[model samples]
Target chain A: MAKSTITFEDINVTVTVPAGTRVIEVSEKVGSGITYGCREGDCGTCIMKVTSGWNHLTEPSVLEDKILRENMAGKHNRLACQAQVLGGEISVHPV
Target chain B: MNKLELHDSDGKPKAVMLSERVHWVGSLDPDLRTFDIILKSANGTTYNAYVIRGSEGVAVVDTVKEGFADDFFSRLESVADYSEIKVIVLNHLEPDHTGALPELMKRAPQAQLYISQKAQSMLKALLKQDEMSYTPVLTGDRVSLGDRTLEFLHTPYLHWPDTQCTYLAEENILFSGDVFGCHYCDNRLFNDHVGDFRFSFEYYYAHIMRPFKDYVMRALDLIEPLPVTMIAPTHGPILRDRPDRYVRRYRQLSSPSLASEISCDQKTLLIFYISSYGNTRRMAEAVYAGAMQVPDVRVSLYDLEGGEVDPFVDLIEEADGLIFGTPTINGDAVKPIWDLLSSLTVINIKTKLGGVFGSYGWTGEGVPLVEDRLRGLKMRVPIPGLRVKLIPTDEEIQACHDFGLELAKELMGLRSQKVLNFADLA
Candidate 1:
């Protein structure tokens, strides 16, 4: 049970979160502006680009991975519900 | 094959009701209406898996999709005798209909799998995974329900290869698969007590069976002679009350489309967004400039200006592809685009592709934001989407060319893809 601090770009607000938390939930908590619908891991709505810390995030879910497989994931994108932050400092853009 | 789950005292067909073994779980995409979401969000689903009680043996009919195997089993345990299941009647082999086959067979080893001959081969080709078992039945194969009779009718083109319908003469029910079915879910099992069956049935016919209207017409002709009181589909509520009402509706669907009511085949490109200063509109026009290069791609753009609440379903119906453009609003997409996205709850369009374009000053994911909303509609988008910074650029225009070319190919297929292979089937 490890927790780590995550940062948001614009506001520079950081919050402690449990390990394996998706950037989406983190963004939601800090109000970092991510749009998402169909949270069942299909719709690529909650996708975010791993700008700085891709390693801190777990691999995307099968649905997200499928989108990537089809080469449709937005540039540097991953679904937030499916992506987990192993947590450290990470940069995410809600693309 | 049926082992006779229920029978009248004089050896006729009867049950407290049929197949107490079935269960329905929550829908995967409630927001997605194709799965006919009812009973808390499992869209367009009945999750039908029935357990039969027989004198000599027991069996289950159909199964939930792989995603809902756990749910199917748990629900089966509540009403039916699961441990004694002897045979599983697989009327069709669509993955959604057969997703739990392997899991169910493994758990109930004693039960024999029963499927139509065509369905057996289709299932083999479909569930190509090894270690499967089944008993094949073709037309006239009668499965005894102790004293009652379960008859098999081979309906090859009932939406899929090797599809068939099962008629339990004793119970006077026809377990229809994709045919004569709709995409709506309800807690009530019978159609008699249910709300509007009109929409679900029409949607199913229009979306799934509209193209195959001719065979459906022939199929209707074949069923005219049978005195069926109940029609239970794999999706939506069972029709026990007025089965003919649904049948008449199906008949009308098979009837020829009037020249006036025929949905226009004209191509449409749906562009969605909000432009503050005409910067995004310029980029969108560039995308359109590229899209128009391909012949016959009619296009429409929505500014979402002045709080327009128009859902634009006709455009959704017409478009082969959708291109979205939006500038950053507050921290998310402009409220207008968000409002449009929210209203797009039901899009029966399938296999449509898309693109996202935008321009903004110090943009915080403007193009990506709109693209995400488009993806929620289940439309595919080609890679390397154009995202112009502040205005359309040479590179953005180049990206636009690629998007148009990719969409043009897909639209070409819709126009020319010989979907009417029924002549060969017949």
Candidate 2:
């Protein structure tokens, strides 16, 4: 399985995991930041700004997109629980 | 059966029977310290799923949180097989109630999902399954299952937009999703047998249901006529004894008593103002003096320059009328005034009287902009906005006073005549 690198820019921490790992799982494993509520995309608590390598993440699901739009998030923002890594380096920051 | 026998003789938790055909197939999380990262659940909580067995098939109303899937499935299997589930009712699309849905749908692939009409897109998004088939239900929609019937009441925004209530006709039970639910978890399945949960009940309503009080009232109106003997909500103890008391409490909490208080001949008028250079402050004082001339109208003035808008929200919601005074900076109203206007979204101010008075240099657009926002919120702007140049002259100050007086008179007339239009009564 291919590996993906995730950089939490705000905390200056980086982690490596399998390509298909959800960003929420990485945050939980790190346990430093990014508070969560509902884990599903219904709540916008886990919204993160994709600072770099945005194409390395999966497309936002309908729920994630709706919630992100509701929160007035920009195109670079994605829900940590809804977007999975696609085998590349992705840098993000919690909004 | 006695309440103490919630567990088997071996002391393991078992499914409790609500009626001959309705079983409480839910999971209890007694160690849960918090919910949704906001509410503190010291008494823990329960994900109350119910199983209804008809002569022909079975239906499941709601499911537990994702972590409790094993317990939920064990309890569910104790009453009915996974293949027997013909219907799955999603009372609310929030994850606490629908977290186990993916696994449940996989096991009970034959079950058809039913939700409120507003919940279609939400269901698709939450389940991440756009192709999932579901029956959209309205207020009076009903689905028959042999000898029993499941009726849906479209009660949206009890806390979420996808919320609805399911009533079981044969058992006289209301599967109220989160309406009368609490976060207190206990082994006692029924409210009659549980300890005092008054704090938990009120805490749940204050934290979850308070923001949508108008919807709570609307939801109450929809369920008022039902002969509901039991209220099985998606959380906490089942209200099997005098469930109407909970409904009455909701009604009392949601109903604003300010209107009735005005009927006793005392009405409140709030004047909020933010003045940059004492020009708008003079105009606000004139407006306050003018409003003070009206009989039985209590006027309170607040300067918004350095004050927070939150403390005045309840007062603003209860006031009979409101006047906003602002000093135009550049081409718009001051930020404090805009902040005050934005805070109105959380409260119900639909038909209240509103007026705007401001002092601006050249544009004088601040007063009209504030008036437009008040009108956009569905408030009644009986009089046009009052605007004066940089500082008000004596005559303009009197005009500001008269603006306040006329608006107060309009409010009094509306209250007295009970008419939507002031001109109609005049």
Candidate 3:
């Protein structure tokens, strides 16, 4: 399995994990301060900006997309709990 | 519309009529000393129920308390027969509103029950009738009885989850369950005819509805746009004389500014604590003072032991920063603090600045445990937990103050960063 690196810009920390790792998991591993609730893409609390490497993350699920639209989040926003690292480096910041 | 023949010998109407089609079929309890074991009802109260005759069938909105079923049934019978009742609307499931429900269902066996979607489980549990069936309604759902239409608005948590308001389309009357109601029992029936009840009205708001001010605001928003000529609540006199004034008063009372005088740009920090020996109270005061020192930050300090936690839930939900103070007893934080934390699950407090501070005699596990819980709830804790041994010295108090100041600064920094990020995105 390929590994991907996630850079938490606000907390100034980076972590490398295997592919298919959720952004929330990487956040917990490095204490990157990306706060989340429900952990199931329902609360819209873990919304973060995809500062770079947008293609490195998986597509948002239907529920996540609906929540993002309801929150009026822009195209750059993704719920950390719902977005997974595919295979490349990604950089994000909590909104 | 004026039918002078309907008046009794004394000029008082035998049946309280709000309009040509709607009638007040409710019971008055002028002797009620108290209500729900908390509200002090000096002038007693009224269980306001209404009967809407729609040329085809009748719809009954709510009922009196259990013991007053006879009064409710007699009034109901005067306007329409038990068989004529086609729809029963339960706006709220509280006992005072639904106490006569079991009997009413028995008499009006063919009538269908309508309630908010959230009241499905509550209906079965409250009446202890597992087989009871009801049509769950939503915000825009409506039911027609020939000519008149009843539109439901899902205005929940005005005080209870199952709470809702019904609008009479033709008459423009809002059958609000408990909102804009008081504990005053008056046979005059209408707000214009009743004696002064401003005290009871405000008192009712403070006791029953104040705890859920955020929801009150939400409920107000839902009902404000309607062309309501009258507000017939489940309690107190029906508001037909300038009903909008009462609605405006509810809007004023539930406004966020009434809780704390913080403007939109300003931040709010809340410090909640429970003290067994006044130690934690002192610590909370110091934290409040420290947080207040920061410009554009409003601080509120509450002693949880003396007050109920429900009122603070909305305040905390709107706050930018929160600090919990406790006195560790038997290796744990007090029950009130834990109760308050548990209640936060219903609201999203994610990324809000959180801190834990307390005074303990021996083990200071209370502070760290709360901090861990806050972290689990997704709150951004900027600093470690602060603990003081037993009573705090002058230096220890200073440390507590510094803790609050640091947390407030971090909150301010986060707000600024958010503004900058939004600007960049724009």
Candidate 4:
């Protein structure tokens, strides 16, 4: 599987995350300026918008579907803690 | 019909946008007089649905009834597109909240449904959507929608087994389902905007939330640690400015120690009496007057002659002392007094002071029998059966009053000595 390049546009940072890696973990490795709470998706602290490549992220879990359904506005947003990289490149923007 | 026609002619929304990301997309039934053929809603009601817009997804917290589908969906559309909505959370799966679910599902077909683990079968059965897919969330479960996370807190028996509350972490908003809801419809949308809703709020509490006081306390304890800035209940005005005020009020209402007047420096005495020919009633009146002599004691008198036993049973659970009066007939207490005493034995009445008095035409076995029942229930009988032959004279009535004072003294003595004991140990 190819590594997915995730860019944290707000912090002007980018990181190569392997497929199936959570965006939150990748952000932590690259030292992105994203805040988080209750990393299990209970807290929407690490919510981020995907500027591009929304489908590159893995399908949200039952919990993530609810959080996104409740707080997010568009299809291009995902919780960094719960959203895993599937393939291709993705851009992350702090909401 | 004209008013309704004019209202529909105007394409404006009755809903209010509460914040940058939150919209109060609920419907108001201003003429609804009753709820579920019970629970009087004099001020009508509101079925609240909220639209929360996160950076990447749009979610609807709950939906209104089917009759108000146009109003609910229009209000929802005023904020966001239905097709764009990705998820719908049913904090409570009651029909009033989910009446529009079928229609909502049809319109927002892309949206996934979320309900509590316990509500899965019920929701499916209720909607008859056995094949529908839904995510069953637990207490600490979390869902993320871009830059926002919504946490579900399982607070069962806020009147239902499958009830839960949604917590928006970034906004510090608690969509508290039915836990803090009242059947009030207001366009104002918030506690600060609405003036003095305390009466209806408490009324709603007593009717809907009172039976679940234990769960109320538990739910309060669960959310105590969260930085809750707003309480957006599925009904009535949302608590945004002072959410803690409602939470604290609920805490005071549900605390077992604060259930009645006994929590203060006062004790409550409940007197149950049956007077066949005004004799036992007179003795009960004397007991009531005598008990009132104590500065910090509350007394409630119930006539067993014509009333039901259930409410008095609730009073029995709260009172610090029990006093029974009966007119002895055929060597036993009147049937009503016996009925009251029998019900007392079935109840787990706590240790408290007990007093019994009676008016006897012949053999006065009734007073002793009442006393025996009290003793059987583990009550401390300070004043033994005060048996009087027929109606009591003025002097005997005074003695009956003294019997009441004895009970008050015993209660005061019990409380004061306990305090002293605790102080000494400390």
Count of residue pairs whose backbone atoms collide, per candidate: 13, 0, 0, 21
lDDT of 3 by residue, B1-426 (tens): 222233457643345788989998888788999788767988899999999999788999999899878777877777889999999999999988898999999999999999998787677778887788789999999999999999999998778888999999899999999989999987777888888999999989987887677789899889999999999999998999999999999998777653456566778888889888888888888888888778877788888877887778867867888899988989999889999998775455767878999999998999988987887776776567789998899998999898888778776764232211111221
| Per-model TM-score versus the true fold | 0.46, 0.65, 0.67, 0.56
lDDT of 3 at B5: 34
The numbered model that scores best in DockQ is: 3
Give the winner by lDDT: 1 or 3. 3
Order the numbered candidates by DockQ, best leading.
3, 1, 2, 4
lDDT against true structure, model 4: 0.77
DockQ of predictions, in order shown: 0.02, 0.01, 0.10, 0.01
- Looking at candidate 4, what is the lDDT of residue B55? 83
What is candidate 1's CAPRI-style docking category based on DockQ? Answer: incorrect
i-RMSD values for every candidate model? 25.0, 27.8, 11.6, 30.8
Model 4 - which docking category? incorrect
Give lDDT tens digits, candidate 2, residues B239-343.
999999999999998888777655668788999998888999999999999998989888889998667877788788778788999988889988888888887
Q: By summed lDDT, which 10 consecutive residues of candidate 3 chain B come out lowest? A: B417-426
lDDT of 2 by residue, A28-81 (tens): 544324557789888887777898989999988787777887665767999888
* Clash count in backbone of candidate 2: 0
Which TM-score value belongs to model 2? Answer: 0.65
lDDT of 4 by residue, B1-426 (tens): 112211234766645666788878888887888886547777788889998888888999988877887888888877788767888999998888999998999898898898987787678668987689889998899887798888999888787777999999999999999878887766566777665677778878876777667778888888888999999998888898879888998998776652443557878888889887898788889988988888877888888867887667667756788898987888887787666666653234635667889899888998887766665455556455798999799988998898887777777763222111111221
